[model samples]
Target: MNNLLIGYARCSTDKQDLQIQRETLTSLGVAADRIYCDHGLTGTKRDRPGLTQALAAVRGGDTLVVAKLDRLARSVPDARWIAEQLTERGVRLQIGASVYDPTDPMGKMFFNILATFAEFEADLIRLRTREGMKRAKAQGKLRGKQPKLSSMQYKELRRMYDSGDYAISDLAEMFRVSRATIYRSLERTPVSR
Candidate 1:
């Protein structure tokens, strides 16, 4: 069918619902049969089966539509690559009401700008998360995960390691942990008596 509209929707986790995206795409005139969805898959993952299928199904004049650009990809490289792929295939990509016309230089520029903003937003989120963690640590509220072993246990581990009588595997078996955990415990300072 010429001038077909195909839609894509994605949810990042199993707990998330794709209903909102589905509704939006349906309202935008994408037929149910024309809609593809990737469930419980991150935008960063390149192996999304639904996206692969959607891309494979598009024809020269067909439009691939999404509720939002982020639903397509959060990384600029991935977004730009996908846009280039569509351009090469003579397919149009649309996000909400905005369409990216690969034939138009201004449309390509706008799509690049959009992808840059998306990448920037992701970096800002990461920076904010790191800063928040640093502030929490400064306030003494950001202790990481509780230690798997107690101080006494760690001290005992170090003593056992230094004695050379027990193998790392033996210590791991004794402590009911992996050899890596035993090794990590051995690196701790000896506990005071």
Candidate 2:
């Protein structure tokens, strides 16, 4: 199985092309049939069918190849998990021109450092998003989508519901809103606006 090389490629969506990764794998001498791809699927998701198939097809001594580290996984833990699985199965992991050798201390150190950077990058993005949301709220532009019913309309609906003359279904129908919406309206405190 040492001669057997399996390649995997992924794109975030159907609109994205796998051609570049495919060409890279081909140039690396992996047969077209041996290459697997997940289209319109995010790298962050572990449930990719194409990746599952490629892993299943791997045999002892076979090499799993990808064009880049991110193409294989989006996070550090995920990349490490895949690498561990390959090591357990006696399969080699290759990224672009370099083959990862976990047994080599330098290689292990390099991969760990790279994975840490990827995780740090993701964390930074999340922090920036939180800051942006805070800024929006400060500007009074952070209100979510407007309610289906205006404040006055909701007050009227509440009054009708409290009277107990109308069934919830009937009120929902009259208001042209879902029963859940009516229940939510009943639960809410009076809105000034």
Using TM-score as the measure, the top candidate is 1
RMSD, model 2, all Cα superposed? 3.6
TM-score of each: 0.88, 0.76
Best-performing candidate as measured by lDDT: 1
Residue pairs in clash, model 2 = 13-40
Candidate lDDT scores, in order, read 0.88, 0.84
User: Can you list the residue pairs that collide in candidate 1?
Assistant: none
Model 1 ranges off by over 4 Å: 128-143, 191-193
Q: Model 2, range 147-191, lDDT digits (tens) per residue?
A: 978888788897887777899999889989999998898889463
**Candidate 2 segments exceeding 4 Å error:** 123-146, 167-170, 187-193
In terms of lDDT, the poorest run of 10 residues in model 1 is 184-193
